[model samples]
Target chain A: MTEVATFLFSAIRVSTPLVYAAIAAVITQQAGLLNMAVESMMLSAALAGVMISGATQSALLGVLGGVFFAVLIAMVIWYSAFIMKCDLYLVSISMNAGLVGGTVFVMYLATKQKANTIGYIMSKTVGKLDIPILKDIPFFGEILSGQNIMTYVAVIAVAVTWFLIYKTKLGLRIRSVGENPSAAESVGINPVKLYGISFALSGVMAGLGGVYMSMGLMSYFARDMVAGRGMIGVSAMNVANASPAGSALFAMLFGVSDTIANYMQIIGIQPQLIAAFPYAATIVLMAILAYVQHRRYQKYLAKKLSQSGFEI
Target chain B: MNKVRKIESIFELARIILALAIAYGLSLLCLILVTEDPLEAVYMFAIGPFTSMRRFGQVVVKFIPYALCGVGMCFMYASNRFSMFGEGAYLMSGCFVAVVAFLLEPFNLPLLVMLPILLIVGGFFGGLIGFTPAALGAKLKLNELVTSTMLNYVCLYFSLWILKVYLADPDITFFASRLLPDNVRLPQILDRSTIHAGLFIAPIFIVIAVIIFFRTRLGFSIRICGSNRDFAKFSGINYYKSIIWAHTIGGVLVGIGACVDLLGIYDRYLWNEITNYGFYGLVSAVLARKNPIFAPLGAFLLAYMHTGASILNYTSEVPIEFVQIMQALLILLISAQTFLRKTKNKLIFKDSQDAIMKEGKTA
Candidate 1:
């Protein structure tokens, strides 16, 4: 029972960054853009967060700087895609490659250390929350207590995203523009401006995810530390059909897989095999998800045909 | 009509020049911001490759793998599929070739007989890995991008395990295979420079790719399937067959390129991670607009910039990563169709109007 509680707690902790990235992905994907630049934004923000926090000795300033940098890059992406009319995927690939190199260069320039890590900087890492009365509850307390503040923010972000996407007027405009840009234009909505704003919101969410990686999870920044979480977030958003609650659920599933992999490593499993588990799990899960969706669509089509009295 | 054609060609040339100019301008700004002596850094970046034959040879050395992979990428891009399995294909092919070469070291076989066997085996394994995502996409309705990306990590971990268990050299602490035999190594083409016979293979393959792309019925089928799938299907082209064949051939080309790079550059398989040549090749393919004939030129340009950056890194305190930023900027500018669309339209419009007025006078 204790092990299960510990596992659930760790899964929530691991899912926090992924939850943030998925929110970012959901926003852009809803705006009719496939933004693979999430990884680049998160990585750049991770480095920026660490550097700023180290210099200013304040986590709040670091978070602001990180979000600002990510939003700046997101705007550049918007200009490149909308105004310049570049292929979005190609722009994303280039930005990812550039950030991979740029982060290392900037890290070296700032700290005079190797490009791999900034472990010596003693940055302000985010503190964990310990709710007073909640901490005394039996099983629930064990599962919920001692998580980073970002984890709570991630949960709140899901609710906020849900409200913004389903309940607000801007959400309607964004969805209409995504569904059909021409039709939206007929209604006097500027698809380009909405897309730019959506991209900026995605940047903000990805920035928070990046900060979680450096400040909430680890105390220092490392090269390519976000790894493939951004991509996994993309897959989660797809599986969820761009719904915030569904994205959070899928993110938690991945987080569980990650925790299982880590546990296997601790129990003396081969490190290489353990490393492959999360990716293999993702592939299998994605295949299953695709199959289920296909079956559902087929069933729905058949039901509609039957109701309309069409021949077999 | 002829005058309009000439103007269109000139506009295309001008667009490329403008993109290059912007990329270089941004790079200059970066240097000025980062370095103490920005002018010297810029000079070294622009002119250093020509200062020595060795540096020029470095450009040629980098060009071979990039051009080969670029040509390979043209096949997949032509089919309009964004599969990223090429990175895994390259890495695994190198791993297979190293294993083959290690086993063949004691046979004392002739180099002519041995090299072809290694290339075929290496390419076969790479194609097999590449076939997975294609087959999955066909059979299960999966996204090739996600599947291919996942497969890359899977292959990386699998290869690392193989190296640790079967191929590790106990003498070395790092995860690397044993040194390959002399007979299996590529012969040098130049005395002072590290230019190898493998460099010649890239151009030959490029020529072959160009011929196949331009002259073959299969190539036409592939292009049709990419541009208009419904039309291709209506015209009785087998979409699945064309797509599978394109990806398989692309995988073989990249695999061969990986083998060449491993044999020509190093004595042993020393890579613990992905070499990223496949990504560079993808960039080259994009730069060439998925045209096989232009891929070599694009690869050469990228390699030249990389060589110049390395020279700058050696001479000044500036980092070599600036080249990556410059390359990204170049790709962004070049791929932007609307960058100077107004200017291009005006030029073509003027030419067409001139042609119309000439016809009116003649009549």
Candidate 2:
């Protein structure tokens, strides 16, 4: 029972960054943009979080700086995609690559280190929260309480994203612009402006996720530490069809797989094989999703053909 | 019509040059901002690659892998699939080349026989890895971008596993595969540099790519599908087959490129991290506008910039990562269809107006 609870606890801890990434993905995906630069955003933010917190010795300022940097990168991508009319995918891919290099450069400039900011900076970390009354409960409380504060924020982020996406008037405009930009433009909603807003919102989410990685998850920012989490978040968002709650659930699925892999490493599995497990699982999940979506599409096509009086 | 075409082509060329200049200028600005000795850093970055024969050879060495992968990417990009499996394919294929060399060492095959087998085996496995994401995308309608990116990591970890389990030299403290026999490694061709027989082998694949792109029916269909999927479907082209074949062909080239790089560059399989040649190749492909013919030119330009960046890294305080940022800026500026769209439109419009006025007078 304790083992299961412990596993669930770590799963939530691991899922926090992914949850934010999924939320970020959900926002952009709904705005009819496939933003792969969530990786870039998270990475920049993670570094910024470490740098700011280390410099100023304030975690709050660090959090803000992290989000700001992410949003700034998002705006750069937005300018390229919307203003300059570059291919979004190409822009994002380049941005991802550039930022990976840029972060190392910046880290090198500040800390004179290439690997991580472990010894050079005394970075302040975000505090974990132990929920009152909930901490008293047996298995469930042990799983839920005393997680990194970012984990709670991730939960709130999902709810806020759901509200922003489905319930608000801005949500309607975003969806309208995404669905048919020409129609939205005819109705006086600028798709380009909505795209900026979407990018900004996603940046904010990615920023929080990055902050969790550096300040909350680990004490210092490590080079390429976000690794494939941002991409995994993308995969999660893809699997969930861009629904906020669903994306979070899928993100949790990755967290579970990752946790299992980490455990498997301790149990004498090859480290490389263990490291490969989560990604392999992600591919399998994607394949399944693709198959299901294809089947659905075929069915829809068949129904449409029949309705149009075409021969079966 | 000819004048309009010439004007448009001139505009396209101008846009590319302007993009290149801006990226270079911005990268210089970054160096000036960060470095105490701005002039020294900028000088090295701009003129360093051409300073000596050895440096130029380094550019050529880098150029081989970049051009091979760039040409490979032309096929994938032409298919409009946005598949990024090339990075993984390159890394894994390179690893496999080493693995194959090690496995065949006991057989005592000659260089002529052994080299071809290694290249073929590497290409086959690379093609197999490339086939996965493309086939998935073609048949099941998966997003090739996501699947391919995921597969890249999977390939990385799998390669690491292979390196650890079977091939890692026990003597080396840091993890690396066993060294290949001297006969297995490609012979160096350049006098004062690391340029290998891969230089000769790279052109063969480039010629093959050129033939496939310009001379083949399959290439025509792939191009048609890329440009207009609905048109291709209406014209009865097998869309799935074209997508799969394009990616597989790309995968084959990427694999061969990996083998070339592995044999040409190193004595042992030293890559523990992603080599990033595949990603850099995408930049080359995009710079060439996805034309296989222009891939070598694009690759050469990038190789030069990369060599300069490394030069800057060693000679000054600036890091080699500066090139990556410049590459990103280059991709953005060059690929932006609207960057000089107005000027292009104006030139074409003026040419059309002139033609119309002349036609009116003739009539």
Candidate 3:
């Protein structure tokens, strides 16, 4: 029971970063752009936030500062795609590289550290809130109650994104742009503008994820600290199919797998062989999604043939 | 006298000169910002390569594979797909070839017989990995960029796992493999430089790639498919077949590059992560504007900066990791410009603007 409880806790903590990244990536992808810059965006936010917090000792500024810098990066990518005749993938890879260069360049100027920041930022971690009656409850209270502000924000983000994507006019435009930008433009919709907006918003979300990393995973900004979360989010996005609720669920599942791997190391499991498991799982999920898409495509063709009264 | 000629000449010069200026300025900026005596580090890192015979040799050692990968990537990009078969080829073929080299190096076979065998096996593995996305793209008409990038990571993890489980030397705690015997080592150039036969091989292959890209029927089909794909389909160019060949060629280059890098530089293949060499090659291709012939020059520049940055790291406080970051910055700048220019061409805001101009003239 205790092991299960600990695992569940660890899962949520790990899931927080993935959830932020998945949501960020999904928003951009749904707008007909793959935001590979999310990695840079996240890193930019991480460094900026920590610097702000370190200087001011204000956690809010840390969160804001991170998102602000990430937004700036997203804007550059958006403008390049919208105005210039550049390939989206190429632009993304470049922006991601630039993010590292720009940040590392600035890191040295600000702190004189090469690999990481020089200061120790002790920004406040999100305080946990326990409902009085819920706290009295046996296992339910312990499992459900305590999590950081980002956890709450992530939960709310899932609900908010679901409502926005399925129920709102903005979602309609986002879908139209992704499926066929030419057609979207025919109806007076600005596909480029939509992409630009979606990408920036996605950057904001990814920036928030970086905050969770600094405040929850560790207390300070470090070099490449987001590690593979950006790519992990890419994996989760495949599973989610850009659906907010699906992404959150898969993000949690990924977090759980990560938890198992982390604890198994305590029991002397080989870190390396087991290390490939999450990526393998992600690849499996990608293969499964492809299979499902192929099947659906075949089914749609078959139905269309029958409806048209075509020969069998 | 000729407007088109003048514009072309100007833009061409702008491309090369501006790029170099950025590179030079960047190094200067790093030196100035990171160290008190910026000139000393710059001189040591960049100019220092030619100052010593040994260090000059080191540059040659690193230059071969970077050039090869860059040229290969140029072909892939020219096909209008970010297939990036280089990564798949690099990891799959390099790891397998190294294992074979280690196993065979002990048999005392003549180095001549062994070298070709390893290179072929390496190139074959490279082509094998390339076959995946080419086949997938032909069947599903899926986006190649995302798929290829994702696959790179998967290949990295899979290779790392194999390296750890099967190939890692059990006697050593460090994540290195059993060093291969010296029998298969490439003959080096004279004492003036560390130039190996691998350096010569890169140029030869690149010359062949240039010939194949321009002169051959297969090359024509690939180029046609990239430029006016619909026209190619109308002409029965077999777009799918062309894509396969393009990626296959790319994979072969990656394989050869991996082999060259392993033999020319390090004693063993000891990568715990993706060799950014493949990525750097892609950057070279991008900078070359998908020109296969020029790609090697681009690759050389990138590789030189990388080597020079390491050289810089010794004397300056600036980290070599910053080189990776700056390279990324250069990529983003070029990629963004390319992406935006593509968008403009596709939309032709000019067409609409031209229409408005015509109406205004009539009014």
Q: Pick the candidate with the highest DockQ.
A: 2
**For candidate 1, lDDT tens digit of each residue in B1-363?**
677778777776688778888888888888888888888888888888878888888888889988988888888888886677788898888888988888888888987888788878767876876777777777667767667777777778777777777788999877788888888888989887878988876677678777877789888888888888999999999987888777787788888888888889888787777667767887788778789888888889888888899898788778788677777888788888897889878988887888789999999
The candidate 2 chain A region of ten consecutive residues with least summed lDDT is A285-294
CAPRI-style quality class for the chain A–B interface of candidate 3? acceptable
lDDT of 3 by residue, B100-147 (tens): 887776588987888899899888988877777677667655445545
- lDDT value, candidate 3, whole model: 0.75
Which is better, 2 or 3, measured by TM-score?
2
Candidate 1 chain A least-lDDT 10 residues: A111-120
For residues A168-216, write the lDDT of model 1, one tens digit per residue.
9999888888899999999899999999989999999999999989899
lDDT score, candidate 3, position B63: 75
- Judging by lDDT, tell me the better candidate of 1 and 3: 1
Report chain B TM per candidate.
0.94, 0.98, 0.86
* RMSD to true structure for each model, in Å: 2.4, 1.9, 4.6
Task: Give the clashing residue pairs of candidate 1, or none.
Answer: none
Which residue runs does candidate 3 get wrong by more than 4 Å?
Answer: A117-124, A129-135, A267-269, B1-6, B137-143, B170-173, B332-363
Per-candidate clashes, comma-separated: 0, 0, 15
Worst 10 residues of 3 chain A by lDDT: A117-126
lDDT score for residue B217 of model 3: 96
